[model samples]
Target: MVSAVLLAAGQARRMGQPKQLLPLDGKPMVWQVASAACGADLLEVVAVTGAAGEDVGLALADLPLRIIHNENWSNGQASTIRLAVQSLDTRAKAVLFLLADQPLVNKALINNLVKAYRESGASLVVPRWQNQRGNPTLFDLSRWRTELLQLTGDQGARGILAAHPQCIHYVDLPGPEILLDVDTPEEYWQMQQLWQQYKVTKG
Candidate 1:
């Protein structure tokens, strides 16, 4: 079974507040992301929280997902990734990593990646937009579990990707949602503006 790990353990230092709790279309950023993950074709969804663990939990209280707190969140993203990966069920075949700040990643993108992974037999599945890779990358745990467990510091699977480029199967996708991430207050505001514009365009 494929499992998803939503990383929401960041301190959000640039935003001066927990970006996970910030409102996006009236829902907390993490909640929106988790909701999208829940809508995907996955066996389980796990949300990793840190500094704002309590509020993140509250925001996702209604969701049927597991919440895991990372005590080493200050050590950077790798720690949270390790925590999520280690906590995965033994039955899990592959795992998809999602970021809490990338609220635009919807169910379709995730399901598409899963479909590609199942059909291509690739150890790594990533989305590419205009030749640029994007987040919510899926890794076959049967191949990379040991390497992922040994990961340290903030690089967070980057070193693994660099070392195993041949294992990747990039899914060509449209739009910048694959790369759009909210890191600061200004970026969050910009995301809202862009979301509004997108809504108008879609309508």
Candidate 2:
């Protein structure tokens, strides 16, 4: 079964406050991400919280998820990732790693990724927009978990997977949603505007 891991342990140093707690369109950023991850098919959602663990936990209280605290979150992204991976259930065959700041990514995009992974037989699958790779990257648990656990720096699993280039599969993402991440107040506002525009266009 495919599982979703939401990485929410960042310090939000640049943003000056907890980015995950910041609301986008009336919902907390992390909550939005949790909803999308929970909506994926064959996925058990787990959220890794750090920085302001108490606040994040409160925000996520309504969601049904296994929350893992990254005590070493100040160590950087790699630390939180390792904590989350180590905490995953043994029954999971594949795990999709997603970022909390990506509130713009929706349920449909995550479902597409899980569906493609099941059908494509790829060891590592990432959503590709133009030439840039984006979030919600999936790693086949049977193959990549050990190597992923060995990762130490803040780069996450990209460098390890890149070493085995042939094993990577790129699914062309339908929109810029894959590339958008709200890191700052300005970016959040821009995303809100973009979301409104998108809703209007779709309607």
TM-score of predicted structure 2: 0.94
Which runs in model 1 stand beyond 4 Å of their true positions?
Answer: 200-203
Best by TM-score: 1
Tell me how many residue pairs clash in candidate 2. Answer: 0
Stretches of candidate 2 above 4 Å error?
Answer: 201-203
TM-scores of all models? 0.96, 0.94
lDDT tens readout by residue for model 2, 76-126: 788887887888888988999989988877788888888888899998888
Q: Which consecutive 10 residues in model 1 have the weakest lDDT in total?
A: 194-203
